[model samples]
Target: MTKLAINGGTPVRDTYLPYGQQWIEDDDIEEVVKALKSDYLTTGPKIKEFEEKFGKYVGVKYAVAISNGTAALHGASFAAGIKEGDEVITTPITFAASANCILYQGGKPVFADIDSSTYNIDPKDIEEKISSKTKAIVPVDFTGQPVNIDEINAIAKKYNLIVIEDGAHSLGAEYKGKRIGSLVDMTTFSFHPVKHITTGEGGMITTNNKELYEKLKLFRTHGITRDKEILYNKNESSWYYEQLELGYNYRITDIQCALGISQLNKIDKFLRRRREIAEKYNEYLKDIDGIVLPYQEEYIKSSWHLYVIQLELEKFKVGRREIFEALQAENIGVNVHYIPVYYHPYYQKLGYKKGLCPNAEKLYERIITIPLYPKMTDKDVKDVVEALDKVLKYYKR
Candidate 1:
C-alpha cells in the first residue's frame, strides 16, 4: 500500500517539527538572569568574555561581537575599505545581506554562479566575474558546508582581493582540519534563535588581522574610541571619547552575550546531535528516488545548519511547492533557505535581472529545507522521514 498523508492517510507526526530550532537549557536561562541582574547590560564584561571565548574556539586572534549577522558583514565590508564605485563578488545563492552589505558601503555586488554539486560559490565562476572594478570576494558557506577556501584564497591573492567568508551557517564547521572563521580575511557568524547557538539575536566577526580587528571594534561602537592610544586628541578625562569615523551603533548587549556564552558551552553537544540527525536522515532518505541530497566533501566537516533536499523535478508528479505543502500537511514545518538574492524585488529595482546565475536559480527552484535541529527527538526524525516518504511515494512518477 502506498500510504499518502495528503490523500487522508495517517500523518506521521501529531505535533509540528520545525526545520530548525534552538536548544535552551536551565543553564541558558540562569545565565540570562545573571546578566539581567548585573551592573551592566551593554558594553559590559560579558561582551569581552564572550568575544575572547569565541575567538579562542575558532582559533582566531580576534573576534568582534556585533549586533547581528548583517551588521557583522557590514562592519567587515567597511573595514575592508569597500567604497563607492568598487565591486564585490559574491554568490547569488545566499541571504541578501551577504551581498547587501557591499551595497551598504556604496559598493556594487557582482553575482557569481555556484558549483552545481556543492551549492556553494564556484571559484571558476568567481574568477570569470572579476573585472577592474572587483575589490573583494564574499564566499558564503551555504548550508553549513565550507566552500573550497584554498581555491578561493588563491584566486583572491592572484587578484589582490580581500576575502570575507560568510560563515553564518557554518560556525562549528571545519575545513581541512581547521575551523571556518579563521581561514579567510574575515568571517561572519550569526546567533539567531534557529542557528547552532542562540543569543536570541546576535552575530560575530572573526579574523587574524590586527588592523582589521581594531577597526571592527571601532565600527561596532559608532566609530568612537576611548583608548588614549587610538584617539586623535589627547584627553586625560576618563569620560572623554572621540568619534573617529562614520560608524553605526552595531553593538551586542551583555544579556545576549551572557546567553551566547551559555550556549557556546554546549556547542559540542549541539553539534554532535545535529550530525547524528543528519546521518540518520542520510540513512533513511538515501533510498528515496527522485531526490538529490546535500553533498559534503571528504576534506570538510559541516556544522549541518540546514539539511536541504533537492527534488528531481523531472521525475516527480508533484513539484517542489506541492512536496513542501504535502509535508506541511503532515505537520512538518519545512522551509526554503533562500531565494537567489538578485531575484528579490529590491535587487530587481537595482536593475538585477534573472539568469544572473543559472545554477543558483535552478537550485532555488528544487531545494527544500526539512527538519534538522538538535531539539528533535528520535521520534521526530522518524516522523519527518516517514512523512517525506509518504509524500515521495505518492508524487514520484
Candidate 2:
C-alpha cells in the first residue's frame, strides 16, 4: 500500500516547513541595533549610504528608498507620468500591486497574457494590447525569472512608452549580461521579510535617468523640494522648502536602511543557496510524471524566490487542492503564488470580467509554491521531495 500522511502514517517531516522565510544573522541584528542607537533614525545618513551601496550593486546611477514595495510602484508610476486616461500594460499573473499602482494614478491596467513556458509576459501579447491610450509597460519578473527585456524595449520604443520593471522577486537576477535594475528605464524592488533581503519592510526604485531620479526623490517625500533651481520663490533659507507637485510621504526609515545594508552584503550567499535548492528540486523531481518544474532559460539567471511546481491533473486521480492538503498533512507549508488579478471581486466590480487572460487563469488553477529558502538543509529538501512523492503515488491514476 502507498503510505500517505493524511491516512495517519508518519509524515515525512516532524516539523512544519514554510514556503519561504527570511534568514537573519547576528550581523543583521547588530546593524539594526547600531541604527537604533544612532542620532538619526529616519531621513538620516544610513539612507544615503544604503541607496549608494544599492545603486552600485545594481549598476544604476540613482536609487530612491521608499516605505514599501507598493509605494515604490506608486513612485515609479508617478515618475513615468502615468495619469488620468493613461493605460499601463502588464501581466495578470503577478501580485495586485503591479497593476494597482496604475489605478492609484487614475490610469487603467490592460492585462496581457503570459508566455506559457517562461511564465513571463509575452512581448507579442504586449504589442497586441497597446492602444492610443497606452502610455507605459509594467513587466514583472515573476518568480525572479527575467522577462524578455530586449523585446519589451523594442515594443516600448516603437510606441514611445515608458518601461517600469517590477523586480520585487529579482534582486540579484541577471538577463544576458545586464543586471535587472540596470536594464530598464526604472526598476522597483521590495524588501519584505519573505524576499531575498529584508529591511523589515522597505522598497527602492533604481534608474539611470537623472530627471526620473530627481522626480522619484520628490515623489517619495510629499513632492517637497529644497533644491534652489526648481523652487518657485527665491527662499535662500536652508530650512525653506516647497511642494513642487502632489506626492506621498513614503520615506523609508534609517533603521530599515541599516538592516538593508547588512542584508545586501550577504545577497550573493543568499542567491547561491537559493539556486542550490532549486537545482536539487530539479534533480529530484525531473522525471515525476505529474509534476512540471519551473522553466529556466540559459541566458537568464533567476533569483529563485519561489520554487513553483505545476500539477498535471491527467496523471492524477485527485485534484490540486487535494494534493495541497496532503502536503500540509505532511507538515509542508505549500501555497499558491497568485490568483489572476482580474478574477478578484474588487477587480470584477471595475468591469474586468473572466476570460480577460485565459493563460493566467489556467496557471492559477495548477500552480503550487513549495518550500524554498536559504535556511533549508539538504535533508529538508529531501524530506519535501519524499513527501511529494508519496502524495503523488497515492493519488496517481
Candidate 3:
C-alpha cells in the first residue's frame, strides 16, 4: 500500500488521518453485522427506525432516507416542484451538488455571493439574484457552519420562494437555537464518510410539510406507493400498488440505516471532539498574520466538519498552490473546500463567467481545508499547527 510521506524523509504521524473520516466504533460494526444476519437487509424495519430517530434528532416532522446526498437533493428539488426553466438561487462556495441538483431538474442555478466572514450564502446577494422565474434558494451549510437561515427565510418569504438547505456538512449544526434541519422548508443531509456521521453512503431529506413528505417518499422509490388505504377506496387488496409519478430507486439498505442508528448514538461526542480540534486550530493560528481563521456567527453553532483557513495573499510570498504543496510536503493533508460552482465547465457553458460572485471567487483563491475529525488527539493537532507554522515561516514574504 502507498503511504503519504512528510518532507521526503519524515514519516506521517498516522497514515490514515484524512481531512475527515468516519468514526465507527464497535457498536457501529455490531449493528451492521446484526443487520446482515437479519432476514430483511434492504427496505427493512431498521430503515424506518433510522428515519424516525433521525427526524426526532433533527426536530423535523418527517425524514426520508435515500441513496446519497445528491439523491436527497434531487428528491427534495423534485418534491419542491422545481421544473424546466425555473431558477434557483444558491451560493457558489459549495460542493457542486447544491447547484447541479437544480440543473438535474432542468432548472437554472443563479450563483450568489458568500458572506465575507462565514463564507455562507449572503441573503442580500440571494435577493438580488431573484426574478420571476426564481423558484427556490438552496443555501449550503459549508464546513458544518449553519447559514443565516432566519435572514434567508425572510428573503424567501418576501419573494415566495422555497428553501432547500444543503446541510451535507451540518447534521448537528444549529442556527439561532433551532436545529438546521428544521429551519428550512426542506433540508438534505449527507451520510458520507467525511461527514459528522456516516452510514457508509447515505442521505436524507427532512421536511415538516406532510404533502412534500409524501411526495418525497414516492420520488425516492420510483414513485410507487403500496399504501392500501390510498390505493383503494374500500376493497383494499394485497399486491395492489400505484405508480403515481416518475421517480428513482434511491432507497438505502437497512444495513446502512443500522449503522446510521449506531453512529447517531455518538453524535454529541463526535461533535464535541470536532469542536475541540477546531478550537485548537484557532488558538494556534490566531496570531499568524497571513492566515484568516474561520469565524462563527453569533447566532449559529457549527458542527466543525472542516477547519478551513484562508490565506492572506498580501502577506504571503507564494500563492495558494505553493502553500498547499508545502503543507502536503509536511503530510498535513490540506485541501481546498471548493472552487466556485460557476467556474465549472458545465456552468460556464450555461453563460456563467468570472466575477459573477466576487466574494465566492475571492474565497476560492485563499481557502484551504485542514485536517479535522473526531479521532485526532492533542498531539496530532499540535503537530499540524507546528507543521503549518514551519511551512508559513519558510514561505513568508
Candidate 4:
C-alpha cells in the first residue's frame, strides 16, 4: 500500500499552505501610517491619489473607490439603472455577489451557463437568456482570466444593455492588448487581502462614461454631493450639501485607500510573481493524469489569481470529497473556487433551483482551487505540486 496522509500516514508538509494570501511590506504599512497621522482619515487625499493612479493604470477615465467588491457591484448595478422588473444576466460560477447585486437593486438575476473550457460566462448563454426586461450583463473574469469581452460587448450593443465586468480577480489582466478596466460600460474590482492587491477590504469601479462615473460617485457616498453645479439648490455655503437621491454609504476610508495606493505601486511586481507561480504550476501539472489544468485564451493575458484545477473524475476511484480530504490531510489548504450562485440557500428560496446552469453545476463537482499568490516561495509551489501528485497517485483507479 502507498502510505497516504489521509489514511494516517506522514503528511507532505509540516504546516498548512493556504490557497491564497496577500503580500504586504514595510512601505505598504508606512503609507497607511501616514494616512492615520493625517487630519483626514475617511475622505482624504489618499483616496483621490489611489483612484487616479488606478484609473491611469487601467486606461480608464474615472475610478470610484468603495467599501468592498460587493459594494462595487451594487454601485455599478445602481449606476446601470437597474430597478424593479429589470433583469441582469451573469454566470452562475462566480461568487454570489455577482448575482446578488441585481437583487440589491430590486432586479431579477438571470443565471447563465459557462464555457467549460475557459470557465467564463459564455456569450451564447447570455444571448439565449436575454429578454425585453434584460437590462445588463455582468460577466465575471473568473480566476483572473478576462472573459470574452469583444463578443460580450457585441451582444450588449445588439440589445442596448449595459456591461459591468466583475474584474475582482483580474486587477492586471489584459484583453486583446488593452487593460480590463478600459473596456465595457463599467468594470468592478475587489481589494480583498487574497486579491492581486490588498486594501484590507475595498473595491473600485472604473468607467469612461462621465454619466456613469458621476452616478458611481453619488452611490458611494450616500447620494450626497457638495458640488455647486449639480446640487438642486446652488449652495455656495461651505457647509452646504444635498442628498440628491437614495444611496448607500459605501465610502472607502483614506486608510484603505492609502494602502491601495501603496499596493498599486507594487502591482506590476506582484503581477509578475503571480504569473511566475502560475507558469510553474502549469509546467508541472499539465501532464498529470487526473488533473485538468485551466485553459488560457491566447488573446487575453491573465493575472492568474486562483489556479483552479478540475479532476478528471473517471481517472480516480474516489470522488472529489475524498481527494479534497486527502490533500487537506497532507497540510494543503486547497479550496473550491465557488458553488454556482443559485445553489445557495437564499437564492434557492428565491425559487432558483438546481439545473439552472448545467455546465457550471457540472464544473462545481470537479473543481479545486490550489494555492497561487505573489508571496509564495518556489519551494511552496513545489510542495503544493508534490502533495497533489501524491494524493492523486494514491487515489488512482
Against the unseen true structure, what C-alpha lDDT does each candidate score? 0.93, 0.94, 0.89, 0.94
- Candidate 3 TM-score, C-alpha based: 0.96
True lDDT of residue 263, candidate 2: 94
Ranking by TM-score: 4, 2, 1, 3
Clashes per candidate, residues 3 or more apart or on different chains: 0, 0, 0, 0
lDDT of 3 by residue, 1-397 (tens): 2222434545445453467778888878999999999999999999999999999999999999999999999999999899999999988888899999998999999998999999999988889899999999999999999988889999999999999999999988888888889888999999999998999899999999999999999998899888865664446567667888899999999999999999998999999999889988988889877888999988888999888899988888889898887677776778898999888898889898999988888889998889999988888888788767777776788
Q: Give candidate 2's error at residue 63 in angstroms.
A: 0.6
Clash tally for model 1: 0
- Give stretches of model 3 more than 4 Å off: 1-16, 232-236
Q: Give the 10-residue window scoring lowest on summed lDDT in candidate 3.
A: 1-10
Candidate 3 Cα deviation (angstroms), residue 107: 0.7
List residue ranges in candidate 1 displaced over 4 A: 1-8
C-alpha RMSD by candidate, in order: 1.1, 0.9, 2.9, 0.9
Model 4 vs. true fold: TM: 0.99
- Model 1, 1-397: lDDT tens digits are 6565677767778887888888899989999999999999999999999999999999999999999999999999999999999999999888899999999999999999999999999999999999999999999999999999999999999999999999999989999999889999999999999899989889999999999999999999989999999887785688899999899999999999999999999999999999999999999999988889899999999999999999999998868989998899899999998899999999999999998899999999999999988999999999988888888878878
